[model samples]
Each structure stands twice: as structure tokens, then as C-alpha cells.
Target: MTIRVVLTDDQPLVRAALQMVITDTADIEVVGEAEDGAEAVRLTAELAPDVVVMDLRMPGMDGIEATGLITAGTGATRVVVLTTFDDDDYVYGALHAGASGFLVKDMALDDILAAIRIVAAGDALIAPAVTRRLIKEFTRPVVSPPRWSELDGITAREREVLTLVGRGLSNTEIAGELSISIATAKTYLTRLLAKLNARDRVQLVILAYEAGLVATSQ
Candidate 1:
């Protein structure tokens, strides 16, 4: 199936570059483009693309607000936030606002394409550098553990999976860590999402951090 995408950025060059890279793929297509958050939102509503490559600092609505609107407004559309290292301050907010993942602005074009496909396939991603920073940044706070009843539906093995996910381990890594098959690891993640009412892997990571399952040791 062809994955439809919408590009949103204040820079025309960035949008053009992204369009070129995406359209080069046989299974991906750039369906629309927007120069700001409000336009992104409007185009998303109209195009209903499978994924949206959203810049974090667009004028008017901005990426965080646009991500929230796009994710909430369309059940099938996911947003991948594009940012520079300077935009790290907004990463947490963007994830909270429902971005499926994020990509550094200067990352390899191949990596950016992979991220889009990963999110389009119902998984989440964060650039490795962003992951390291996210761990360091959120680990500064000491949070209380959530109640057992809150996690009553999750099995111990599933809790283990969540912890790995919180640490930014991919499905294959989680499988290797637990001596399970990748398919089994994915199954555990799906169950975790349904049981926790989490939206995606990013939310699972946030929940694990908030509940002190991971990123608590200093």
C-alpha cells in the first residue's frame, strides 16, 4: 500500500527536499504541503494522509499544537515531528501532544525515510541522540510509582517489556533482551497498549517514565 504523507514546515526548501526524498520511494507519496501549523491542520483534515512530517517551530499554530490537532482529528493519521537539536525543549511537549515519533533536522535522508515508514507501520521512533537526551532530561525528576491496581492488568513479563520500551529499545532489542521472538515482543507491546489505553510506543515510554518503571536510577 502507498503511504500518503503531508509535509509542513516554514521553510520551502526543507519542504521541497522532503518531498523529493519521499516521492523517490515506490511505496510513499507526498500528498500535500503546508507552511504553518494551521495550514498543516487544514491540509491534514483534507488529505487524511497516513503520516505528517511536521516542523516544530512553524508560525501561528506550531508543531505541538498541530500534532495534537492532527492526531486527535484523524484516527488514521500519525505525525512525525521534525526538529533540530535546539528544539529539544519542545520534544516532551510534542510527544505529549501525540507525535508518533521525531527526527533530527540534519539526519540522513535514509533515516528520515525509515522513520516515516516505521511510524506508518504503527511503530514509534526517536532519533538515537534524542533518545539519550530524553533519558537524561527526564531522569532528573524522582517520581512515585503508580499503584499496582493501575497496572493490574499487565503481567510481570509485560511490565518488563514496557521498561525496555521506556529505555528506547526497539522490538528486536526487546526480544533479544528477553529471549523471546520479535513477534512475541510485538504481541506484548500490543497487549500493553490495549491494557494501558496507551496510544503508541511513545505514550508507553512516557507512562513508564511517569510511573518510575525506568529512568529512576541516578
Candidate 2:
């Protein structure tokens, strides 16, 4: 199956570079390109790509707001926020705005492609280093009110899964750590998602951090 992609960056060079890399992949296709947030939203509505590679610093709508609109309105198109090291505050907004995942701009092209594929497959990816940094910067003395009801009705084992997830472990890694099958790990995640009313794994991670289920000490 071809994974349709839309590239959005204010810089033409960046958009062109990403388009070149994505178009080279066997299973990915660049269906549209947008140089700003509003254009991204419009193109996403028109093309309905499987994934959108979005730049966070664009003018007008900006990627954070764009991500919110795209995810909220379309429901099917996933947004991958592209950011630099100084964009931690924006990263926090992006997370709450329904981004599927985030990527540092300087990451290898192969990793970026893999992230898109992972998110398109309905999983979230946050590099461990990036996750730690964001948590360190965003963690407040008081977390916002619980997204759901303070983890009520959740089992101890499920809390373990959520911790690993908040720490940015993939399902395969979580299964290995717990000596369980991958399917079982996925089942736990699905249950957590439903119980917490999360839109996806990214939201689960946010909840885990906000609820102090995961620490930012690392």
C-alpha cells in the first residue's frame, strides 16, 4: 500500500528536500506540499494523505494550531511535528493539540521515514532524548487537572505499561521488558487508550507525564 504524504515547511528548500526523500521510498508518495500552516490544512483536506510532515515555525496558522485543526477535523490524517532544539514550549502545545509524534529537524532521513510509517500504522514515536528534554522543560510543580479520573479503575500492571509507554518505549520493547507477547502489550495499550479517553499513544504519554506515572529525571 502506498503511504500518501504531505510535506509542510515555510522554507522551500526544506520542503523540497523532504519531498525528494519521501518520493524515493518504495511505499511512500508525496501527494502535496504546503509552505505554511493554512495551506497545510487546506491540502490535507483536499488530499487526505496518510501522514503530514509539518514544520512548527511557519507563519499565519503555525504548526501547533494547524495540527489541532488537522487532527480534530480530519480524524484520519496524522501530523508529525518537525522541530528544532529551542522549540520545547511549542512542543508542549503540539502534544496537547493532537500531534501523533515529533521529530528533530536534524535526524537522519531514514529515521524520519520510519517515524512516518510508525505513526501511519497508528503508533507514536518520540525519541528518548527528545522526550526527556521536553518533560524536563514542561514538567510543572503542579500538573494540570487529570485528563480522566486520576487513573481510577486501572490495574497495577497497566500502570507499568503506561510508565514504559511514557518513557517512549515501543510495544515490542515493552513486551520484551515485561516478558510478554507483543499482542498482549498492544492489548494493554488499547485498554489504556479507551479507559483514559486518549486520542492516541501521544496523549497516553502526556497523561503519564502529567499524572507523574513517569519521571523526567533521566
Top-lDDT structure, candidate number: 2
Model 1 lDDT per residue over 114-145, tens place: 99999999878854455656666644453355
Error of 1 at 84 (Å): 1.2
lDDT of 2 by residue, 1-218 (tens): 99999999999988887888887899999999998999999999999999999899988989999999999993599999998878867888888899988877998999989999988988787656556666677654435665446688799999999999888787898999999999999999999999888878889888897787776563
- The TM-score, computed over Cα atoms with residue i paired to residue i, of candidate 1 is 0.87
Off by over 4 Å in 2: 127-130, 137-143, 148-150, 172-182, 216-218
TM-score of every model?
Answer: 0.87, 0.88
Model 1 per-residue lDDT at 216? 49
RMSD for all candidates, in order, please. Answer: 2.6, 2.3
